[model samples]
Target: MLERWSRGLKGLGNWTAGVMDAFYGALGTPGKYLQDFLNGSWLGHPLHPVLTDVVVGGFTMLIILDLVSLIFGANFRDPSLIILGLTTLAGIATILSGLTDFKDTATGDERNVTTLHGYTNVASILIYAIAFFVRLGGSETTGQILAIIGYLVISVGAFIGGHVVFKYGYMVNHNAFSRGRRAKEFTPIMPAVELAENTPTKAALGPTALVLVRRGDVVYALKETCSHAGGPLSEGQLQGGAIVCPWHASHFRLSDGAVVHGPAHTRQVAYRARIQAGQVEVEGPVG
Candidate 1:
């Protein structure tokens, strides 16, 4: 049922893509920096969810305050209006940050889910904005009714947002399932002779995939999967000392797999690599 609804929303992606692209193009390099900040590149987690909490909490409190005013003869109008204003501001911030992150979603299904999630929140915020103005215009009962309606709309939006994250696994760290424990000793991956100089090559140790890059005598290794979106890092391009994910252009340092830029907040899992005998042996997360 929800899947059908999400699929129905897929057309929104096509309609909004050009608009988002225009917005992105206008911002350029500064916008990239702003996107990184909104994506939580500095915080090592998503910022959208955090801001959503503030909006949701504020609205919840507003509902409680309204209920108190209705039940008891208390005049909580001032506080209720204040909460509404703050929550609306937070909702706007949440929408901005969410759209920044949404611009990076690659797949149709993900975009479809996000389209519904985005518009639902937008609608909820609009309702709240209307309620705020209505209250300011001195209509207490009408404003309270609109506030209740806004809360209900936001609740539906919240549910859809959760579906995007939990069901679709959007914005999840791609490396979260891996234990992240370092190999106790060096394990041979492939013959050193096969590893081309300055090339991103894929190898594996048991179930874990690795990307190996050779620079002179040293070989740098990181998890083959991108932390942001499970993009194949071995298929990516090297820039200076970092490798750029081909899918979303996230840059991770080749030496330690530290995130140099994002859409990707968590660092890729790094490994220690050395040539032993005729084979390339890799171990550790390199501290």
Candidate 2:
């Protein structure tokens, strides 16, 4: 059933991708900037999932109030409405962050699953919006019913969100488990003089594929696979002091592999390189 739904989502996304691209592209530089900001490039974590807790928590409170009203026969409409309104506002913010991340997804299962997650959340939000208005009109019974339905919808949405993270590994560090080589000694791969200054050179040291950069006397080494989506960093261009991933445009500092720009929240694996007997030797991860 999940596979069928995922396929359906892919079909829908394929049909709408062009329109979405044009619409998002119309936002231009400002849109890109906002997407980066919401993606938490500075915070080193995805902001959408964090903000979701606020919106989900607020609605959960509404459900509790509904239960209280039912059990005590007390009028809790005012508190419930207030909570719903606040959550609705937060939900809007969450949607913006989520959409920003969604725009970065490629056309495949990841895109399909993410689209389905977005659609489910939007439907849940709409249900809550209706409940908010109904409560404002003093239709307590109707509002409570809508709120219950919305809660159920959102629960399913939350499950899909979890699947996006755990099952598909969305927004996770692709090289989180890669820790250079098991041996601590530096392993020579190639002659240091062969590496061009300011150019990325791909070299393998034991099991690790690395991109080595030489800057006069200093040599820097980073895992060749991008931490985000496993994009090949060796093919990426070195701009300023950072290497930008060709696949997603994620940037990591050449000095320490820290994320200088994102869609990528984690740092790339940094390895220490030493010039031993004129050969570039890769040591364990940078300390």
Top TM-score hit: 1
TM-score attained by model 1: 0.94
Local accuracy by lDDT, each model: 0.89, 0.83
TM agreement with the true structure for every prediction: 0.94, 0.92
lDDT of 1 by residue, 155-248 (tens): 9989988988998778899988883556889988899999999999998877888999999889999999999999999999999999999998
- Model 1 — which ten-residue stretch has the worst lDDT? 13-22
- Model 2, 1-287: lDDT tens digits are 55458777887766555555566579986755666788877777889988899988999988988898899987887888899999988988898788767766777887887888888888989988998899899888898899889888888888888988997778877887775664378778899889999899898888788999998878889999888788999999998999999987888999899988787888888988878899998776876
Which pairs clash inside model 1?
Answer: none
CA deviation > 4 Å runs, candidate 1: 179-182
